[model samples]
Target: MINLTINGFEVEVEQGATILQAAEKIGIKIPTFCYDDRFKPHGSCRICVVEVEGARSLMTACCIPATDGMIVQTESEAVVEARREILDLILANHPLDCLTCEKAGRCTLQDLCYQYDIEETSYDGARKSYEKDVSNEFYTADQTKCILCGKCVYMCSQVQNTDALCFVDRGFETHVGTPFEQGISESTCVSCGNCVSVCPVGALMPKRREKYRYWEVDKVQTTCSYCGVGCQMELLVKDNKIMEVLPVTGHCNEGLLCVKGRFSFDFVSHSDRLQKPLIRKNGELTEASWDEAYNLITSKIKEIKESDGPDAVAGFSSARGLTEDNYLMTKMMRAAIGTNNVDHCARL
Candidate 1:
């Protein structure tokens, strides 16, 4: 264990813990622009710079490991000034279109600027004029809004294992995109949108129907129904409509979702979606109440069981249903119905 004093609070953390981790253990909030818990910290943003008791200069809290008897000040006067300057430099080139950008409510850069009381950039520097990459079907890449944090690049390459994006050019001209600065559609990009989830700014925005503010939606946790993997996810709903699908870190997917799991949730609110139980009468399917449908199903199943035995009434549970529901279906078939003709659609 290593003992460190972060913002005057003495804390102990396991060996190899970073200064940022130590500060967090002591309830000190050190803002970071390029830190994502899913990957290793590279400390490229320098926004989490902090003052150590005897260090030569400010050290990035995200990357610098905490040492025994270390005294760290995460929000000291010098550290705050350095962070403010870092935000100023980032804002100088970043586009000031938060109101129009869909990422406005959740943008980390915007929050930092507000925290440091920077209403606008003081530097009138040259901003990148790269056109938006609308080639990808799932999301768009606006380089002008990018801060070159490399979070998307790291997520795509390290987590998704697709090296579709890389740093192109150098210095002020640098931006992350498909290899050789090619369009996302023309490269090895899979449109998984994992990179989009990791992005801290409006540079990578998901393409969706209508815009939504963060506070306008109520998050509802549910499992992805695209497959039987049972990946945990959250449904961002507004006015009884699904606004977005965000992956939740749980037993199955661990905060990562595939292209279908992330972007194929529109069907939930489609007009063609079936809401009521349907009964086939005279070869025509008609909507029926739940009680009526249950009565018809019970009579038909009992008739078939009496005429040709319980084996005649086979039950095929769907994979889309919950695991517990499927288990109950199997139990009813073997115990109550006295048949072994129960199976799952996944087998077929």
Candidate 2:
């Protein structure tokens, strides 16, 4: 255990805990953009810097270990100034297009700028005018807005293990890109959007699937139905329609999702999708309520059983259904319907 004083409040944290973690434990707000638990802490963004008593300079609270009896000032004058300077530098390169940015409401960098009350950057130098890389179907690679935080780079190499994204070029021209200046779609990139998930800014974001803001949508936590893995996710629904899919920390996936779970959710709100039960009435299929649909199905099954016997009604279960559901389908066929004519769709 390590005891540290953050802004005159003494707090105890477990050994090997960073100062940023300790501050968070005590409900102290320390702004950080590049810090993510899923990846190793590199402290590229020095905005989380704090003043440690007797230390020569401000140290990043993210990567700096919390030492016992260390008095840290998370919001001291010096610390605040240092953080402001870092924010100013980041803002210099970042585009002021938060109004229409897909990540506007959810961007950590946007929140920091508001917290520090910085309307704009002080420096008026050359801004990055990199061409937008929208070749990837899932997301756009906006290098002009990138702060070089390296969170996306870390997530790509470490978490996804794709190593598809890297800091390409050198110094001022350095930008996250694929090998040989190729598009992500042309490279080894899997379009997992894992890097986009960890990105703090609008540098990497899903291509606009829906015209809605973060606050406008209601996040409904649900399990992914792509496969039997049962990865947890949140459906961002707006006006009773699915707008986006956000990954959630659940037992199965741990806040990460594959391409299908992340980006292939447009089918939910797609025009071709069957939104309701359809019943053929007067030679035309019409929308019907659940009760009407179930009643019709029950009546037909009963009529079929009486006229043709249960042998004529074979049950085919879907692979998408749960194991217990598949079992119940077979059980109904054998016990209730008096037939063993049960099979799985996968076999066919």
Candidate 3:
């Protein structure tokens, strides 16, 4: 373990730990934009700059290793000024459309601006603008709102192991896009929406949610029921109806999801969902009350057991059911019906 001083407080950390990691361990926050725990650190933003004693210039805390007996000042006046200037440079070329952006309330850039009390853009520079690319059915990309932090690029190419996005040009004209400048729908993109989840600003957003602002909806955190992957997702509800789905970080899925788990949740409230039991009468199907359906099933099961023995009855389970429900189904099949032939299609 290496001992260091962060913000005048003694902290012990691993030998190869970064200054940002040590500060985070000691409850000292260093603002950052391009650093994600799940991805390799790219110190391109320069917002986590900190002053190290005996150093000639401020170093990026995210990339600088914490050495023993090193003294780091996270929030000195010079450090704060440098961070504000870096943030100003980022905001100079960024679009000023936060009110209607999908990442409005949850945007990291907006939070950092508020933290530094930056009321306006200090530099009057020409803002770069790009046409909104909505070619993909699942998501849209607006390069004007992009901070060039490479979060989406790292998430798609490195973390998810899907090289669906990459830097396409050189220098100031560089921007993230698919190969051959093809639309995401025309490329090998799988529409997992991991890039959308990691975007710090409004560059990447869900296509279905473009009509409404983020603050106009309610977010409900719930476990995904699609597969046994057991990923955590947020159901964006509006007016008692589901609007979209967003994956949560550090969960079972690591903020990544398949197409089925991300977009197939509309079946939850589909009109074809069975709300009540159905019975066949006079060669036609008719809706029946719960009590009537229960009685009919019970009578049929009793008749089968009495005539053909308990082995004549069987029950099937579904994988979509909760764990407790599956457990109860197995218990009832073995204990009540005394039938070992009972099984579930989910077992296949």
Candidate 4:
């Protein structure tokens, strides 16, 4: 264990731990942009700069290894000024359309700027120009709002193991793009939207949410119904209508979701959803009230029991239903209907 002082608090951490990790252990928050816990520290964005005693200059806490007896000041004036200046530089090139951006309220860049009290840009010049790439059916990439932090690139390549995005060109003219400058729709991109999830700014956003604002919907936390992965997500409901889906943090998904879990929620609003129960009457289907449907179902079960025994009555449950519903269905089948043939289509 290596002992270090961060924000005047002495703490013991594993040897070779970065200052960012150590500070995090002691509850000292160092704002970061390009640092993901699952990825190797890139240190491209210097927002996590901190002052180390006896060092010539401020070092990036994300990549700087903590040595024994090292004293780190994370909130000194010099450190705060350095972080503020770095954020200002990032904001200088960032787009000023946060009000309309889908990531406006949840953006890390906007949160960092608010933390450091940065309200206006100091540098004034012609901003970089780039067209919005909406070729991908799942997401949209706006180069003008990109900060070149490489979080999307790292997430796409390292996390998802799909190298759909890469840095193109060199220096200030460099930007992220698909191979051959092709749109993501024409590439082998899996459309997982991990890049969109980790993007610090509004550079990458879901394409379905282009016409909506951040505050225009109500977000409800719920478990995903796609696969057995059970990833958690926020269902964005606008006036009782699902507008979009957003992934929740600190859950089983770890803020990452697959393509189906991210975009395949239209079944909730599908036109075929059974709003009312239907029964065949005189060889024609007719919508029935809940009471009538239940009574008919009960009479059929009684008839089947009297004619073909209890084995003829079968009940099927849905795996997508909640735990309480599953338990109740099992209870109703075994106790109320006296049937052991209860099963679910999901099992098949």
Best candidate according to lDDT: 1
- Candidate 1 is scored at a TM of 0.93
lDDT, candidate 1, equals 0.88
Candidate 4 C-alpha error for residue 268, in Å: 3.0
- lDDT, candidate 3, residue 32? 82
The worst-scoring run of ten residues by lDDT in candidate 1 lies at 173-182
Model 4, range 303-326, lDDT digits (tens) per residue? 989999887788888877765677
Q: Is candidate 1 or candidate 3 better by lDDT?
A: 1
TM-scores of all predicted structures: 0.93, 0.85, 0.87, 0.83
Write candidate 2's Cα lDDT for 117-156 as tens digits. Answer: 8889999999878889999988998899899999888888
Using lDDT as the yardstick, the better of models 1 and 2 is 1
The true-versus-predicted C-alpha distance at residue 2 of model 3, in Å, is: 2.2
Best to worst by TM-score, what's the order?
1, 3, 2, 4
lDDT of each: 0.88, 0.88, 0.85, 0.86
TM-score of 2: 0.85
Model 2: CA > 4 A from native: 278-316, 322-348
Candidate RMSDs in Å, in order, are: 1.9, 3.1, 2.7, 3.4
lDDT sort, best first = 1, 2, 4, 3
C-alpha positional error of residue 59 in candidate 1 after TM-score superposition, expressed in Å = 0.8
Question: Tens digits of per-residue lDDT for model 3 on 1-348?
Answer: 999998889999999999999999988888888898888888988999999999999999998999999999988999999988988888888877776666877799999999998867889967777888899887899988888888888988888888989888887788888888887888788988888888888899876733665678899988777654578888888888788888876458877777766777778788998888999999998999999999999999989999999999988887766677777988887898888866766678
Error of 1 at 118 (Å): 1.4
Q: Regarding lDDT, does 2 or 4 come out ahead? A: 2
Error of 3 at 192 (Å): 1.0
